[model samples]
Target: MHHRRPKNLRKPLLGGGAFLLLAALNAPAAVSFAEQRYHAYKISRPAYQRQYGSWARVEVPAEYRVNAIHAALLHTGKVLLIAGSGNSQKNFDAGTFDTVLWDPVANTFKKVPTPEDFFCSGHSQLPDGRLLVAGGTARYEILDGEVRKAGGGMRVKNESPDKAVTLKKGTVFRSPSGIEYVSKTDVTVPKATREFEVSYFGNGAMKPWKTKVTAAEARVFVEAVEEGPQALTTQAAQYEVVGLHGEDADNVYGLAQKLTTEKQDFQGIRSAYEFDPKAEKYVPVDPMRDARWYPTLVTLQDGRVLAVSGLNDVGDVVPGDNEIYDPKTRKWTKGPTRYFPTYPALFLTRGGKLLYTGSNAGYGPADKGREPGLWDLEKNTFTGLGGLTDPDQLETSASLILPPAQDQKVMVLGGGGVGESEKSTARTSVVDLSKDSPVFTDGPDLPQGTRYLSSVLMPDDTVFTSGGSGDYRGRGGSDVLKAQFYDPGTNAFTEAAEPTVGRNYHSEALLLPDGRVATFGSDPLYGDRDNTKLGTFERRVEVFTPPALHRGGANRPVLGNGPAEPGADGRATFATEDAGRIAAARLMRPGAVTHTTDVEQRSVALELTRGRDGRSVTVDVPDDRTLVPPGWYMLFVTDGDGVPSVARWIRVK
Candidate 1:
């Protein structure tokens, strides 16, 4: 029906027609907005969350937020977050080390008094429920062009067999060419060793022995007293020890190689401490013999911690000067020498050997010590394992003993090329150490090549892996926000809830006592896609609730009135109303993680027996000390539906 319109109405009709045309042209954008809103609603629904899980960004109080470079789950049900200078040069200069204690249950935070810059430290759970934290940043790295002074390592010699020599920090060393360098740290050179050997003559008389004396040496970082090119030296030189005379002057001397205004790598400290969860403070212990940055501390079967691989005091790879810390003695002794890149992923096996998964984070020759192997600690032998895909891309990879650690299987997941290379891989490999000839076999690939990926062991017998970047330190805005669940039984991955935050270098994910996973830290190189702006350290901590937690109501089994301390191979009875549904029990080692390496987290299966009363469950702890290291563990009972109860702290003596 064609109808004539009045002149006044014609203009309004024309405007309305134009509006309709514009809305029609932008239909895709309107539809997209509506679809996004619907997707958000759908995921928030109980039904959808029960299947795919859910993620919630934790609202950390602004004052308590920290970089969280290191995270450890304590027996107190609180997480310790250490950010020691937080990778910030300004913070280091200001001496602003930080640590925050977060109680997930109470949602409260407390600031800790950090004594040193533990920015690149190594930590492990101690048998006494303390956290042994060792090594840290002694000096920040100075780039080549920014280096203002000439510095290098100096070897101080004590030629006197009678008395040792102590060189103070400001001790001056005069080079042969008259350039003076000052010691940057105190060093004590041991007295020369004197040995006498006797030879026995044929059946009757003893021949006189000759005495041998060997000079003792100690190394210390030295810097030219003066800055700039005038202090630079390109030749190795012997330096006269200042403030000495006569025999003392001759007995003490300094030797150093070329000291130049070159790039200075981050140096490490020899300081070590044990964080007491009960007292909520770091207690200083005996220092290590060698300074270390980016070290890895693994607990031995005897409960001693083996500290290995890091940059030493002079900003050099530690030259395999590993040491062991005896918790009982509170001292460190020389360990068997074995070189590895910094923060190597080493797991202790049931046979007391360490399984090196060929996964490391930064600092070493790409060709050396990058092979996957089994290491004999007593004999100092390494047996290399083969068949790992993308062998060259093991740096920043995540390695873990797969669930039911008694199976003696370890897996390596996702890695990148050495250093800041742009290369990454999606490879996943598993090595069953129980095999006659253990070699890594390829598992399912990740959705994309990733680095700094965090793998957390869930009580439900699956691994939750999430948050990594496609490039080095998330350059080019390459942070991968995806997450997945890896089923060791199926040797495959299934998609899980996606993380909202991007975690890359220096990130960590740990399973909380409640079965949810808490993630922290991400220090990207740049904030923008174009890599133009410096990236801020991610201070926001995110928690992921796995599908098992969202299946229905809070019908989780509750552990009540269990033994506070139980001996290995002993049975402990726990009261729980849901004991009848308890299908399995596990002793989960609390996580102490940093730099994507956590040898501390493992789920050891316990033999479970439901009581006849249907209100109690008795579980037997394994007798093997290597299989179940002595420490405080979270006792978790899972139902047939894979729902885990809130953990109860139990000490395995």
Candidate 2:
């Protein structure tokens, strides 16, 4: 039955203002730690150090209109930018959805048709290179209507004909429906199959589901729904109850029988569609069993996508029971029944269990219930893993399973204090999830506590962190333009080049094929909640050139020939000018990141063996799905100094 959540279930959104106390106590201490490390490495270097990376701003032509509320790096090498309502409630109500395609190679943007108001929808790339977009804004709730209520009563009809069994008048039997009712007058029952009816008292505000049953040798049946109370009286009979629609119907919601005209509507949509990159349009598919908003989609090893928690049609959180989308059948089937905080940052482990890093994208229950853990999908169980000093501060923080896929370490960094407040955290943590009992431990801190930060795994196995705000939604002068890089070897973050423009909420970055990182989109308030002008709606695109790109022309190796496709006898042959000097081969999945969560970003190190001819390298392809799932990948070969060559796109399937 649908019921209001407990008072303790709700949590505050992460923000900057809420972290003042934390910053005052921790910021100075962090500074002292940095001073101690100055002798080891220059801690005060300028953000634009040439040894790190260089950022260049690119202007978009006027004809291109974009808000970039949503973005993804497509397999075709174009960035898909979507902005429904441009973050405006009025536009959302009007159903104004916009989309654009930005081609980095061509340095141009083109307008594209939008499928629906996928304002807060969730998406993940399929193995076929298509993007599966699920959920959207069905409608917005406005508070202009009066509260509605209903009178309670119950009635029953006899289906089977039989001898009359007399029922006494004033029979105080309860109505087994949402309308909490009690018998007002009990009348004599006719032997020709006696039927019963009862009037209920109260509006059935709180009731459980009722089902058909046999009581006192008489059969009683009611429609099985999330509402309608099950009669709980001193009655004796065998009950045969039919299950409700959808698996886990009780917790699925949207089955409430009670009517409440008073509603704050912002309803979530159940529309499920596939974006065909080749056609550059969305193809409608079967709708999901439940409406979802602010959901997260993760691609499973078998190519199906597991869509986790989100708000339901009525804007209430859909507590648990995630669904899976099968690409082959083009249908959504009920997956393992489980409870997950909305948009949980889940990573598929080598063992096939899902690891929730405790860094949810946004919204859902907080407190201990949302703690980090490893979820055994097959058994529908969770193993809670604690150790985060500040779990409440991870609302917009970026988390990732560190590079080289083999390393089972996951990291969470920078977030706000609580709900839409202006306080954030510079704290970062890492945990080796492979451990039997994993727990997060403190890692290097960021330059300052931040939110909306984006961390992309580079070809070199180091992570690149950029774009975020010191405050929530880039408000209160919390814009952070400088970028940083995290080295797993040292567990340290080094300042990198600063971008020409600042990016915070709604911003994103991805590694490009040419070994540079493309950064764009920052719609904190101009087109988001609060609608306050904290920073301009970011439309300008920029690219960050990693230090490897600064090497001498001769030192930068070139791909003489493409590597063999994956699954081809598990061997790949590559020809390059620096083949003799090439020390490593790696495969990097193109990024499809949004909301600071890049569920698609992954890297696999390939075994490199020099060819007998001394002019080519024979790399052994990964045969296990855990190491390299079927999909498109950018293969890069790095020299002894770690300077990588331009990537050659190849399919692992």
Best by lDDT: 1
Can you tell me which runs of candidate 2 are displaced by over 4 Å? 1-49, 141-265, 526-536, 552-555
Model 1: residues with Cα > 4 Å off, grouped in runs = 1-36, 197-210, 567-569
Q: Which candidate's TM-score is highest?
A: 1
Query: Over the stretch 1-653, how does candidate 2's per-residue lDDT look in tens digits?
Result: 99987766444423444576688889988998887687225422434234766777777877676677677777787878878666667777676788888888887787878868887788887888888899877655445343222211123222223433333322223223332322222222233233444444498464544443232222111222223224322332222112323332221111123323344445567889998888998899988877787788988878889998877764666668689999999999998877665667888778778888877766655563467888888898898888897778888888887888888888999988656776789989998977778899999889988998989888888999987988878765668767888999888888776676788877778888778888877876543345465446777878888876665334676677755475458887777557778888888887766678777788888888887887787777777775566677888888877788878877777
Candidate 1: C-alpha RMSD to true structure equals 3.3
> lDDT of all the models against the reference?
0.93, 0.71
* Residue lDDT tens for model 1, 1-653: 99888899999999999999999999999999999899789879988778889999888889999998999999999999999999999999999999999999999999999999999999999999999999999789989898877998888999999999998889999988788999877888999999998888899789888888899998888888888687888777789988999999999999887788889899999999999999999999999999999999999888999999999988999999899999999999999999999999999999899999999998999988899999999999999999999999999999999999999999999999999999999999999999999889999999999999999999988999999999999999999989999999999999987888999998999999999999999999899999999999999989999998898358887888878877454789988888888889889999999999999999999999888989998999887889988899998888898999989999886
